[model samples]
Target: MGARRGFQEAVLAIVKKIPPGKTLSYKDVAGRAGNPHAYRAVGSILNRYDAKKWHIPCHRVVRSDLPAPRPGLYFVYAVLCGNGAIYIGQTGNLQKRWMQHRNGTASDYTRRYGARQLFHYEQHGSREEAVQREKWLKTGFGRKWLKREWKAGRTRQAGGTPGGYRWGSKRKLHLLKKEGAL
Candidate 1:
């Protein structure tokens, strides 16, 4: 437990050094945390930490490449608009991006439609991959897949702001597979 706590502190310290709008790869974070080969463990530490409680910027840690192979870094996300439309996007930082949408800084479309809930999302390896996936999700076939796969009733309520929704385990795993995110 002492060793785990030490690693957590090291990870948190490194994460806090990441500036807003900037990011570090999990491997990079692990190296800085004094264990060059602990990239996966670094990711686990970040995932387990409560960013809200500690003011740690876990979102700043991404995969070394675009569209990460695992499902813990960058993402392609779908937001349910108040007008019943779905908005697709990609981001290295999910929490920050959601905040931007809620605050009207993300896009004109989201501002106009009003983001009501988080409908779907898939993790990617890197920013480039996430961008590509976001493009696909905006296409007709992708839209059809989303409509068929997404259960509107299962979407977590947004409550008029970002940061209110947490991903349910089953839905998250299902989306990862359906979107070829693995």
Candidate 2:
């Protein structure tokens, strides 16, 4: 237990040093933590990390095959619109793009639907990579995966309408399993 805690602490320290908007793969993190073969262990530690108790930026550690390339500023973002629609997009500057959507200057669709909240985002290392990821997220399978993975709660409206889209059905779970993301 002591050794496990020490390893977790070391991993967290390395993660904390990652600059904002940049990412390190699990393998890279493990190597930095002084155990080149402990990539999966590094991922386990990060997954179990207590964000409230520790200020480590665990989000910076991602899978090596993540769509992002190395060395640049880009992001793939997802927003839940007011009318129960999800919008996926990519940008070099996330804050600026989000503000544009909020301020009604992003696009006809977003302006008409009204962007409600930022539901998910992933940092990329270049504009090209961001665009590729954005394209993938717009696909049918990717959309389904996002819905199943990031379902959020919504308030009950008048007329007994169902709030929030529920993607926890068995079929969706099966699909996630097939994709090996579960």
Candidate 3:
């Protein structure tokens, strides 16, 4: 009974720690609660979260990799978008990186892109592999890469207004007239 109470308290604390545009998977929550191997149990706990869509972002949790669990993946995707998590990048120490973003020490890219956490993550081997995968995701798809691959919903617009002192066609004509070239 005492142990069960402790778990409940842990769950509530973790949920509270989740920021406005961030998330944590069942696996991540469970692991942080000192269970490391309780993804299924964590999911069960989340499934019964009475607060549901209000207090907890139950939809952000997702199954890792392809051939996902269909409805579950779609649900997670929706939550990610709602939470402003427009991109998905991986790091060797997934948990550590998650902490960095949550604590406001996020990467330049994440800062510029307005991305946030929205679910848990599954381990995908070594850190090198994860870095390589991130690089590939950023490059292989280009614009599609940012959208389909990285899940970047927001974009930095390409060009801004020209400065008041740029050499344009009119400027070139004026210069030629001054030099007697036209």
Which candidate's TM-score is highest? Answer: 1
Sorted by lDDT (best first), the order is 1, 2, 3
Backbone clashes in candidate 3 total: 5
lDDT tens digits, residue span 44-131, model 2:
7766766447766565454443233344878887877768898888877665566566545787877777665666778877788889
> Where is the poorest 10-residue window by lDDT in model 3?
156-165
Give RMSD (Å) of candidate 2 vs. truth: 13.8
- Pairs of colliding residues, candidate 3: 23-117, 25-119, 25-120, 86-151, 141-145
Error in Å for residue 86 of model 1: 0.6
* Residue 77, model 2: Cα distance from true site in angstroms: 0.5
Evaluate candidate 1 by giving its C-alpha RMSD to the native, one decimal. Answer: 11.0
Model 3: per-residue Cα lDDT at residue 77: 18
Candidate closest to the true structure, highest lDDT = 1
Q: What TM-score fits each model?
A: 0.46, 0.45, 0.42
Give the 10-residue window scoring lowest on summed lDDT in candidate 2. Answer: 156-165
Candidate 1 residue pairs that clash: 66-125, 66-126, 67-124, 67-125, 67-126, 68-124, 68-125, 68-126
lDDT of 2 at 168: 25
